[model samples]
Target chain A: MATSTTRLPRAVDPNTVNGWGVDADPRNDPTYPFRDRSREDGPGMAWQRPPLQEPRVEVLRSIEHSRLPAVVGTSTPPKGLSGMIRRAAFRYSESDWRHWLMLLGADRINVVEGIFEDLARGRIPNIPAEMGARAEWRHNKLGLVRKVAIVAAVSAVAVALLRRRGRDDW
Target chain B: MLAAEYRGPYRMRAGRKRMPRIEHPRDALVRVTRSCICGSDLHLYRGMVPDTRVGMVFGHEFCGIVEEVGPEVEKLKPGDHVLVPFNIACGQCHFCKQGLFGNCHEANAEATAVGGIFGYSHTAGGYDGGQAEYARVPYADVGPTVIPDWMDLDDAVMLTDVVPTGYQAAEMGGIQKGDTVVVFGAGPVGIMAARCAWLFGAGRVIVIDHLHYRLDFARRYCPAEVYDFREIEDMAVFVKKQTDSLGADVCIDAVGGDAAGSALHTLFGKAMKLEAGSAIALHWAINSVKKGGIVSIVGVYGPTGNMIPIGNVLNKGITIRANQASVKRLLPRLIEHVQAGRIDPKALITHRMSLEDVSDGYHIFSAKLDGCIKPVLYPNGGQ
Candidate 1:
């Protein structure tokens, strides 16, 4: 609940909003209420696109946006077994984890309980650069190779089944 | 700069927030005048909706004065009073062109489960909502409409969501002349749907809810026949008997997940998370509708499966139509209805609070304390 010092936009003339009252000409259509001032100054209305700006300040939620490998499935995990059980029972439900994994494009079974712990703790730990720690992070926590293999196997099975179903239906 | 924050399920903290600024040329900064705690917001508050990130602001039903306009913004300008639809739509998208503004393609990059919804989770779109003193509105030209000078501000705010959602619920029912329609759930949407059913030439409308207060409110507001599900021995059978064993012509599911009734449904759906919260209301809707009847769902279901009786729908030859209400598409006729005194949208407001007291607003509404039907938040503290 932090505050920003940004000032509010200044108001234009009350009488001549959107070039309506003071600037209305006989040649201009009266039925049309007002012309956009943004159009008058810049690239007119036709080619105008929504310009992208700097990304907004990220809100620090209970869950971090990035992957927390150090805390995810490492040997030295953050929470106790009872704490994990409590979270599973009380704070974040099974459905929430499943939904989170699905949205994160990760396998539900592969996601470790430490990921939930990290979420509960409200801080994302950075990945260690040491070779052994990196190996553990890669092999134990993410298991990227296994994930890819599982995905490929699943896709192959799904394709084979779909083809078989199509043949049977025909 | 006060805003409502999602601390966790059933916990909201109202405190100071960083002022939102225009992040895109299509974005406009709105100084929120009126924002309401919607029933769907309760779903997020209750931890029903997925990806409801903590530290998220949670008010989608709000109207405000345009504090600033982006460079590319054409229609709206500074100082205009505007009502913003919950669904954000990029006007040039395929869905928006088809008047399917709810499913706008460009506004939300996520899968098509939902479009960009203000203050909804990242599942909808990560954009902030109008629950605070200032909110960044994207695609401002498409979703926001100026509040007409003659319209009451409270009524104008309702049109942004609740009014149109209810109207769309009834509209989706395809209620023919003299059709007997039964609406499930007596919340604001259900009541509005039942009321709108009359305008669609419904012969009789019946609303069901377990809560006596809501049923009573439904009866008073919509003037529809009311029933408490707790009193009824069987919902499907009761509706059938009311309609001479044929069931009602159409049924609407206004209650989504977190519906209470069967203990098994609660255990499996809510507790187990095997499926979306108790599909009890949806099951009742499907079972209670007559053969060849339509079931319109405006209820807020979660981002996953539901154990609904699809076999019943198949056997009964039911037509199911469900979507988020296309508020922009239905606004013109609804504005006419509201202006002509046919629908009193503001009559539903039961409590009003300043944005500083938003957590209290969420508590009273969620707990159903103080006979609260609808609670509106005033960011500028006018009312």
Candidate 2:
């Protein structure tokens, strides 16, 4: 006894069907399943509660005024101790040093390319006198190639910890 | 102009395109008027999402009208009717000024994996979605909204993403006053996360699935307790033998990574893609919650990781929580839980077709056939 069948392929078009348009509106199609006409069974919500978290108290009052402290005043010059030892040895976060200098390929973010070339030469200056002379010539050529790659990685980790303390002083 | 067309894995096709505009100054466009078909677009229609781009156009929830707005759009105009929110935020970023609009650090160029999800492809911010008949909308007054005048564009297109991803999967399952909760996928975001876990006072909710028509449509639309984990054979020991084993204080995993009864997890996550599909309902919500429970996870995995057990979520002291549903910070308490009738996101739409039969509504919703749960799609030039 054998009985086999396989036909499926004509993906669509039984005359494009076209009926449930505004997602069914014969007054919302006899309310087919609007959870059996709710408002907990009537009066379509004569205001009984809900809506108080007023958009979570206006998004926590705009995240408490965007965590305050940025009243827009920055004319550069206040980083004394060699810019706090280069912000504590480049410990990142200006959006993680612009995504780690754009994953090391350096997508040129000298403060967003000196604020888009000083707003395309119309100058809205924060520190743009040729953006502090091309950011002091790209921070003195990236601080002499990051201080010679951190003094050649701390002199190859202090010569492998002094050759393991000179073989434990032999 | 018809649309949708991915062309590969479980192929989608639809045809005629090109008609979107205003590429930026905070673009707008829209005109879609309803578009659904999300279960995270079946993880890019089963190729299991990862740079899914063969002319992509899947729909990320949807709802429309505005039809043009860009010179830096000031809160929508030309004919309004909005509803967007499938996270593409950028209202001056630090995560959309901390309402964490789904982590929008300038709308996803993989904002460190996931943040811009419209048509769920290009790992989510390659834009292009609203399954067609127009849709551009980036940042347009921080993710659409409008649709109020007494709602119902089928309940504002399930408030753009299955009722704020099933009300943030029962508000990240904190579910206090009676907490038992359970969930796992019965699908329209697990019947709105078991009807928002009875508005978070769940003394017991349940759900599970293996489909007896989505456990009889989450037992007539959720006040929970539906089952059929293929008639349980150790579904985390039948949910800790129905709770007294001190389990379920909350366990969500609304079925991400295409989970299904394991046959070595559909032969290694749907035929050897390695991982990111068969997490088997996050390994049965980290082995059926309890010892310090609270799982949550509004499902849709595959930005690459997932084979999770994490030593049963660190020895079941669980807590987890998950995201992608910040839908403009839960749209004014889900439009006042749909105008206080208390949640009726269009009774989870059963089916409706025509954006020129969107490839037969994505082949009867990726072949679950007739008892399909949510479908909706319109866009035949706004009918």
TM-score (C-alpha) between model 1 and the true structure: 0.73
A1-170: candidate 1 lDDT, tens digit per residue: 11010121211222221111221123321121133453243441232233434443321122322211100100111134422332332233334555344432311221234346447788442312211233333334555456557989999999999999999999
> Candidates' lDDT values, in order?
0.71, 0.65
Q: Summarize candidate 2's per-residue lDDT along B66-95 as a digit string, tens digits.
A: 878977678888788898988877655444
TM-score of chain B of 2: 0.36
Model 1 chain B: which ten-residue window has the lowest total lDDT? Answer: B105-114
Q: Write the per-residue lDDT of candidate 1 for residues B86-200, one digit (tens) a residue.
A: 9888776445655778876566533345678888865666667888888888888899999999999999999989998998887778766556778988888888988887777
